[model samples]
Target: MKELYLLLLCMVTTSLGKNKSVDLELDYETASRLAGLPLHCAHVEYPNKLSQVLENQTELLAPSELHPIFYGCFDWHSSVHGHWLLAKVANLFPDTELHQNVRTLFAQQFTEDKVATELAYFNRKWGKSFERTYGWAWLLKLQEELELFKDEKFQEYAQILKPLADYIADLYIDFLPRLSYPVRVGEHTNTAFGLVFALDYARLDGNEKLIEVIRNVSLTFYTPDYDCPLRYEPSGYDFLSPCLQEAEVMSKILDDDLEYSVWLQKFLPQLFAENFVLEPGKVADRTDGKLVHLDGLNFSRAWALYTITKKLDDKDMVERLNAIGDEHIRTSIDNVVGSDYAGSHWLASFLFHALETRNS
Candidate 1:
């Protein structure tokens, strides 16, 4: 299983070929642009979403008052991953002006007192399920990037955030067992999408308990599943592909090459056949907050396709998958920047993660 994880990581970070399908080169120019998305919004705390449960008048505090660092980017989860996006770009392109800007942001947001306040927010009864698995997953992923980043400052920041990260981890350890049914929606509540990054953090942290629980829970929820209803996807306001996210989680859990193949064949048989092809989702309105999710759907599908294709042994199938993933990315990568505040507030992280899986 550990070997499978290592293979997946290698495949995710490697280029498919010299003949690229999209112009996703994360040169300093592109990285800086994507970095600008989070940088611009991470501090702009208005037009925010709390997703909170107000128990008393005191609970009506503003978003920034609730989560200082994760208060911008429209919502908590977006801002959490927004920080992850900055950590990623800063690590990839060091000594740049944006890198220093990221450092400054970290210095301001990751202070011990601020993180403690953030932790206090989570402990409230009304806030216990604040972001549930979605925001929890992104927060852990941010911790992963902070610890992975090779810098003294980043290490200190990671320590400052460690208490909250550990708290979130405990929440996961406690929550998974109580979840009798999986959330299969193509939205923030999707259980599979929530597990992807959290699992990544578990493996990175060498938290064997977390890895074991995720593997066990995945097996229980998905092992017997077959013939996923993938065609019925992108229901109106979806930022995620339920079928693809589930497949990605399965790809992570099932270790044996042939075991994964058999499972995938039963679950999404269309992948192995050349007659069926996946297309990028269309968004009718980028200005509408809900409608813009299709743009995110396209990028998310790219991430899943890029990672899932690496599990296949068939060379031709791999190439086809790569092409599909590239097209999905191409369809939305350029649209992410300056699209609309609705989409622009959160789409760059999706685009960045997808591009990284394809060696951007």
Candidate 2:
């Protein structure tokens, strides 16, 4: 009877794994349709037939494009989108070798030299490095990569892997002590990304010492009154503009503090009405409002809110967000279709967390 039960359990486990893999593939395909990117032309074969092709043929398409440090669109956009797609796909296919490809992308992007080249200026002036919002998002992929595969086979190359994440996390930790005032803040996305990375690292390493640091940083921007500054941080990092969406997303994910989420919900309609502009042609970032500076911060938030509401089983919130995202996508198909800003690829990451999250 014991042997029979063991065999049945093994079969059940195998079947469930297979089911998850299939669901992930379907989700990827659906996400591609929702994103409407042109992957077939790029010739970047996707993991599943339904998945959108995500490749930047910029080097092939334009070899003369010299990378002017952080200014090159190809290097900046491709690196971010590529990693986003890879990480989400890996989350979907966790037990399979598909995750290996995700690791490869991270290894290529987060190398010691790349980190130095990208963040050297910030390191010198701030006495620490500044990871762009996109860079912070990339760290999410790397963290997922390490979590999905932490066994002996993966430990061999741990040196190259751990330092990059450790450096970023430690840098943020060091910055905590340096805050001159209790209200020190920066771009919404950067601040949110920093909190998410810090929280995830704290959870992964069982390092509870950093929880206060996370709490303090979060409190600097916590908006229960809605009269606070709603723009992005650093004052000058306004390529896409900052908004409340990224901070909300990070707050939802990192702290699970319902009070913060409630605070966010209270200010949602006013900010959206004032700052968000959804036309049938252009992308939806931030526009007019009290927070006039964050134009590119909406899509990331829209997608994130969509995911979180569903996870929280708040159908009303999901309905509201889906309407918002659908409206934006309808209006700004051109800007969102082929981009990571749409948050299509990170579906797998959210799903992974939904599957893996514990009440603790």
RMSD of each: 7.3, 12.5
Clashing pairs in 1: none
| Local accuracy by lDDT, each model | 0.85, 0.40
Best by lDDT: 1
lDDT tens readout by residue for model 1, 246-350: 999999999887899999999999888887778688888888999999989998999898889888899999889988888888777667765688998889899
Model 1: weakest 10-residue lDDT segment is 1-10
lDDT of 2 by residue, 202-304 (tens): 6666656565676665665544335334433324323221343344444544445565556655645443342444321132332222132222233343444
Q: What is the lDDT of residue 148 in candidate 2?
A: 60
On TM-score, the leading prediction is: 1
lDDT of 1 at 188: 93
**Candidate 1 positional error at 141, Å:** 0.6
Positional deviation of residue 233's Cα in model 1 after best superposition, in angstroms? 1.5
Score candidate 2 by lDDT.
Answer: 0.40
